[model samples]
Target: MDLTTRCLFLLSCLCMLLAIDLDAVEPSYYVDTSSTSDVIDYKDPCKAAAFLGDIALDEEDLRMFKVDRIVNVARQTVQTVNRTDPVTGSSTNEAGQSSVVPNRRGLRRWKRAATSRPERVWPEGVIPYVISGNFSGSQRAIFRQAMRHWEKHTCVTFIERTQEESYIVFTYRPCGCCSYVGRRGGGPQAISIGKNCDKFGIVVHELGHVIGFWHEHTRPDRDDHVSIIRDNIQQGQEYNFLKMEPGEVDSMGEVYDFDSIMHYARNTFSRGIFLDTILPRYDVNGVRPPIGQRTRLSKGDITQARKLYKCSRCGDSLQDSSGNFSSPGFPNGYSAYMHCIWRISVTPGEKIILNFTSMDLYRSHLCWYDHVEIRDGYWRKAPLKGRFCGDKVPEPIISTDSRLWIEFRSSSNWVGKGFSAVYEAICGGEVKRDNGQIQSPNYPDDYRPNKVCVWKITVAQGFHVGLTFQSFEIERHDSCAYDYLEVRDGNTENSPLLGRFCGYDKPDDIKTSSNQLWMKFVSDGSVNKAGFAANFFKEMDECSKPDNGRCEQRCVNTLGSYKCACDPGYELASDKRSCEAACGGFITKLNGSITSPGWPREYPPNKNCIWQLVAPTQYPHHPAVRRFRDRGQRCVQV
Candidate 1:
């Protein structure tokens, strides 16, 4: 036993005598492909740093940033990890909401609630939400996993209102996270999502300020790219760094995105560890992107949420900064029965290349006659990045999200020279997104020895493709046989089996009724771990396999029926199913707990139980004077 203890005793006797039976992977598990290293550039074109830095305005600094957005509207959660932003990839953990920005008012800015009152939107983008309190059962499966990250890339639609009059409550307070940047009418409104605001990018940045956006560094051209160091903030919160004012904001064109998941985290409200409130005006040769990356959204946040929820589309809608558009009167010939559409929008980690330079129209073979179609998102059911006519210059058509639609048909009799595409907005890796998160190779750490990865996740189309593993280390094997991780629901390679996961635990949710999900991550050139981090969102259609009466004791299906819930101390009874005793008559709230009744899971042959603890009777306790002693089985206390 030498040579590293005989390769650690032949990998612990080949992980307890092997196990790699995914319909027989034995061919000694091929597919090493030398490279499947899949990343497919899901466009995040980091050129971020778009001019806007150096601000400190007025209107009493916008009425002291709306009295500091109502003193950072609280409900209170307080996870408190501190170091709120020593910059260098900031650090925030207060989580119980307060969308973190108090480096002494570190300019969390994104103010828009007085555009003279009116711009609440969400009327058709549909957002009804609810949630209520005492949340648990893994916080309601983390509130449908932070609402499937805004139902996997916006077109909104949150549903579930019962007789709506103005919704969006999502409470579980001890407050802090905060919402209310938009639609703040009548009742329900709140948003809180307390205690570390339950991640998933702080519940999609407090539901993008309850679906109305604002805080992408408080726009108004964020001081030309970012550089707000007014003595590293904290001076009366310097009016939360005021700015916003050029028609206050519409940005549907997009650009100045320091990876905007709604930026604000340089050293947000700095004033410590050698202060530096928000720097980087340029200089990204070290390759950037990671300045508050709540993981998704940033294509200028789905291009200003598809221009603030007016998402119908056929043309006109672009952003950040770019120019040139043709096919309609471009140098000549282009009308007589036409159909033009141009949507360019960029900035959520950029992309949209297109550079046809010059062309003559009306071709054949595929263009069908008079064409120019490109789509990377929004309509034509996105994905076909090109469809040129009789052009010849069809190479650069980049965009994987951040919008690019572009369509220009014409055939009321030939239309030539009417083409010249030249669009810009790039960031690299050639990608096309449909919902993201894919890691394994060098993920979290350790992963890279004999590598081989493959990830194919498609979405949109009556959805269904869940996959959730947020983390899974490899190199172990009880049955995974050795460095496994095979998930395949369809997309070739004989698509079928949906499970294969390996050692280091973490592997349960694997859904795939179909919309594609084909992952593979083999590695065995000699052991290594830390490799796995799934997250494939979008799974709506299992309201308990079509029973959908809504809920009673247990029914959990969301995104329609507004995520019907109720199952933890039960309550939804109003003929909603059946479950009662909702604390108050001893349902004891303050965030759910207390079992023993039928818990640790069912018991008691003969029973009679009563429980009540409730907490805080004006806070007072401890006054033991005597003792108790029983002898049925000898119970004693003194």
Candidate 2:
């Protein structure tokens, strides 16, 4: 009972407390209670048990999953998964019955195979995909953008199919959204991008499965990262929470990533509202990392693919106003088997100008082997500006949008010093907003000579584009043939000309007939000035509204204003905002004159004008005998 004995006892008690603390934090995984002898069935994966509500795993990939168990899950479909809605908000059922489901913040919106087959990896990281004809133009655009999302971040590239035997065909089916994991050998493999699956993130997630990515939560080491709530999981969906063994699939030597786009949402396959089927074991200060991020690829997801495909980590998203980038190992020979994508985004009102300073790569007829491709927008499928190879440097490429996407690819056989380029944000770009402002390049300062800038403004449907000049100063011209501002009523230059203005006088406000408006400003080589500034806004429909422009009779909505009109015998009132009776009446005043309705402008058609002259009937004054001009009309009087 001395000091040594007491200290030793206290140390033993502390050790016991530490052991209990460790056990409290340890993660608990799903325990299999079903018999091991349970037979696994193989069938059309898309139609079989592999179709877990929204995900469809192929038979080969399905085998890697352990299915002989009852895992707890619940029905907590986030408001985001109402099936009919792609956005995250309250939605209604087929009977128009709505429920207010809580929104899963940051939950913006997959599976893979085993036995790594080289064929599973697209040849040369180039994939060919076909969009079904049944898809609308906007749906097709969404598919392309989904494909481009991967292309913009990884070495993987997508091309429209052209008689390729093995390719991915995107189809629309109302049978839930799903995609096969990896390439299905032989003919075209199908990926269903069905109703409510047109979202960018959802489509991207499906494409990830096509690119041979397994769900992050299914990793062999996922037991140490997440715990599946079997009671909350949907019945018959336990296979979704099963983990793959170590030998079945490779994790590319990466840690379990909770934010991977391939990871499922916390509430996925839940049986009731607010129930989470998957919960993370680790948290930073008690806040778990969000899963199922459909916005973009996580760092781990990108790294794993790059490592598996031997793709280079060279590209970056450049958002600076001005910056420079080059191919991997620029000025020095770049390694073979390289695929890189660089996206440049600037302010909304500015455009990007990319100029290559040097170029060197293996040249081919189509520049197919090794080349640098430039797109006019951030999407890889955007209009191709050029595909350059060899020693010659390409011309400056200007973007129609505020962004640009560039890619450099090299084959395993050839190597080169590669290319270097710089991008600058300049004036002019597309505008699609309710209201915004646009200014000339270096406005308030003398603009550069021999410059051409185009501005396109698009408002909401059923709304017209209205533009007003805030300030105006361009080179003087008689016919606006020199430096001037040209405006069009439509989205293209071929549309009807609205006005061409120059000199000091500011032109009047302009309103388009439709939702689109286009403008171009040109400066000659001889002269330059402070240029001009303008504001654009959406013009609402005045006549289509309930009040009918407050007009008594008919209301006609023009480009910038509304006018009131009366019946055949009536004309517009003096107030200009009302309709009044007018076609024919008695002329009692001697000093008054007679004319057609709506003079100065075109007169209304199918109208008969009749007037009775009764000049007091007392002093007719020789019946006002005077010469009357025919005025290009024959008078019939009796």
Candidate 3:
């Protein structure tokens, strides 16, 4: 039991303590570079080594050797035992960690388990995050702003803390390398130039990935809806990892959303072989359902997360009867009704004014109704009341309940074409309709009239009626046919009728008459030519009134008198005698004044000036006054 026994017992106890120490320490995470027993081509060793170098160790001191005189000397022997690459005889050193080499097959198998597991969501506590690269205060401000926006919308809370209890941690390191974003075991981390990090939206985007969202462009079924050019995708590269394992399913049964905020900005192929690209394709144009830097968690993302981590108190139990999450309805709630007749109620004796802008005459229609009765037929014309061709038109006024119906029709060929209509109500008494030849004082000579008829009429109080108009047919020709009728009680001035009609026609005839109006007839001393044919009535051919042959020669009809013109040489005297000549040709002296040689100068003596004949050669040559002068001239004969 002396020296031999004591030494053996001490050795056993030391061996036990060493085994216990190894068991207590957590295994350091490492990437496996292994070769298979059966020969198979693999990633290049150098490339693998470079990728390994990219792996950043959180605890760098753990790999650094302590510089001490005694320990340094003792470590020299063990340090000389070089770990060489299996394929190359190169000694492995700290830099060799960046070298790519196949790992033993057994080691690769052990890593497979850890890599296959999906990342766990951060517990209900603060998450620790790290920021790589130097960041200025402004850059951090931007990052905080984005984080705040995310926090407000989502359940996650990001706290910047330096301790392990802190959910998120940030570290700044200046590396010429472009900023890269990724999630460590705890929270999201980013690397970039300080100023650039502040300016770029990459922080929010990377945080999205940290929260388990995928890239929008990498949606598995996205190709079905969007055509992605093969050249845009990286060859032999996986841009995103599936949230669930290859065949696993979440509670919602939804696959990962490529458009998820967590996805990489560029496609797998876009980064090139080195998993790096000088410039990312920021053109979101062709990307359907456009994805952008500020893009937040989509509905699918929220729904999945919510299902997985539901609120215990106010979870799915709350019934959303208001349809808060329902998709929006058609045409929006503001102007959904297109052609339905609307019953508008107004104060008694109130006048309604309907106005439209830039009337699309071809595709617009208007109709009026009162007390559920369809008053005026649907009218297809430019807006009557509003500015047209830079001219103002009188707005129609509705005074009675009978005039309640108003219709608007729009026929723009564009699928989503629409125009604005404004209505104003004027409250007074009944409206007045003047009968003294309703005319437009401001009518322009070159105005082309619209086909629709707009009338200004008065109505008594208690007037109510239905108003409606049909929608214009959609066709290649732009259709903008809509009608809005408003009735108001005010004395608005008459608007100009922009077109001309040659034949003697009355305004009432155009509005109430069932007769069809034809274009003006032109005569060149021969047969007359008819104007354009326009339908005036349901069953009428022409609108012109008929007269006998003698009436055509010049027959006048007065309320109390009638007359007919005689032959060219005949004339009528003051005594009402119809004869060949009223006075003889000889001259006569009257009251000391010389009379004309051809006729009798009758009546007051002062009324007749001394007359004489003047030759046509003495006519005034002044163009200005001559233009107004009569054909013949007489000289005074005193």
Candidate 4:
């Protein structure tokens, strides 16, 4: 097979043996770390396996197990020795001998510790805690299975217990362990479980120690700690209690038992240094049955736990209180101490004014955050600032639906020191309601009305008129209810009044008399007055009559007026106001006839004659008329 194929085969085999699905591997697995020769020839599968195994193993077991387990076992048996204080380089064995020799490789495996400090003090009561972690579903299931085992064996409850006595909080940091602490004032004890621990049984085990249960593996009478076989064991890597430092040892000072739930699982052939002969088991009959894939807690575990720590009677409690308050006058019949955050909603291109009022002694400041949603599943934040004073504030005009949230924070150090003080928030706009509905005021209270009311009336020359009344409502009134209406002609201000009508009483009704000359009305005490439509037509009739010699024809009087006419020799024009002559030329058709004594026998025909200009002596100058037969030329006249 090609080298790559062989390597793939070997990796696939290893994965199957470990019960891991290769498809589930992360990208980090594909990294090439070996030299070119190693990659080409598959020179060292053990080294490749070691690297792959380290990645595959749980973080807790990475440093504890050898990668090439088979190869390491086949080598000439090397006696296992326990290393205590890997940092200080100390070692101990079953013989109780100790030596200091540096384990150079062991130092590389230590992890960094957490350094962040808690900012706020934990409330002095039962605080609820939750778990955060990196365990897969299967891994969590396995952990739970282990937990059941511990619970069955130990009386301690891992999930729920009295709050004052204990609370379990879990987290996911790798290579972590659980611990419990009693508070300084004996308020409560807390149990913290690490997320990295693979075996849930470890939780019950560690909690057991916190409550004072001694490890069964460390039972002094059993002396199983030194009696167990340790052959072909990988030193400083796995399954050796002798490797524990002084701190890892229990405070109770008991001997160790290999079968203890606390004991590490190790290879059967492992034997310890300084043992003259490898002991198969500490006690032949003392061997507990091997825990099945589904190991559970035993009755002995619970009995032993209850003997150490007793349950407490207290329950859980916590405290949270913050901020300030105020009581202020509210507009619109509302009043209360409101600890409020302002929210603004407006349409595009709309401007709104916000007003606030408060009577609190402290200076107040307003701060707000603008929350805008740009698109699906996205958001952005903007800051909003507003004016503020001890009693009032107004927000600047805004033009978007971009919602605003406002908070009023007080600056007086004295306020909200021990307990929060109440404050009221009031918001008002130019908008208002009348009755139950929104409306604009008919007349703005701020407006001033003009004093004079003028009316222009037009009437034909002849017609009787009655009462004229104006229609309007009074929105607001002064103490005296009086106003005047004036009437005027179409001409300039100097024009004469055709007639005048006046009365002290406010008329209920005003009408003209039958003669059409005067106005009349009933008088009541009230001044529900209206202006004149009185005998105005009568005045126009008298003014329109022909005056003096202006009319040369007959005078015909019409209702409220009159017209003029002329005689037969004078014809009246269409205007009926002027006269004109009807005769064309002078009197040329005169025959031997004389009508008036002023008639001429042969008149100058073209001469225009005036009515009073004709003379009696003009025609008879020769006494022809008196003496013999028209002595003037042809004495004919028509």
lDDT of each: 0.53, 0.65, 0.28, 0.28
**Root mean square deviation (Cα) for candidate 1:** 25.0
Per-residue lDDT for 1-638 in model 1, tens only? 22211111111111111111222211111111111112111111111111111111222223222221122122122232334323322243343322222233324233322222344665665676555435543444455445545654555655445456777766644424555555654655556566766777777776776676656666677677777887777643544555555554445445777877667777766667567677657756576545657777777777567656646443454443467777767877877567766666543334567788888887787778688788776555667866887757777776764457787777758657777666765432322244555655434346667656566667777777777664567877678776897887976558998788887677877777777777777787888976665546666664555555444434554322223444433345455455543211232233333332233334223323332323345533231323222223521121
Model 3, 15-133: lDDT tens digits are: 11111122222222211112111122211111111111111212211122111111111111112224543333324446322122222222211111112123334554124444322
Worst 10 residues of 1 by lDDT: 42-51
Q: Candidate 3 versus the native: TM-score?
A: 0.27
**Tens-digit lDDT string for candidate 2 (1-638):** 23211211121111111111212222212212121111212122345333434556444433433222211112222222234333333345564333322233321101122226676777666677766546653565467557767765676767655556778877765454776666766767778777788888898888887887767886767889898998997655654666655555566556778878889888988898799999888895689888878988888877766665666467886756689999888888888878888878654457888999999999998898899999886556679999999999998888876668798889857767889999998766677786765656645356677778788889999888988665678889798898988999998899999999999776888889899999888888998876776667888767797987766666766544555655443555566555533445443444443334444334454455554444444434222213233343444341
Choose the strongest candidate by TM-score: 2
TM-scores for candidates 1 onward, in order = 0.26, 0.44, 0.27, 0.23
Judge candidate 3 at residue 200 and give its lDDT.
30
Q: Candidate 3 at 274: error in angstroms?
A: 21
In TM-score terms, candidate 4 sits at 0.23
| lDDT for position 385 in model 3 | 27
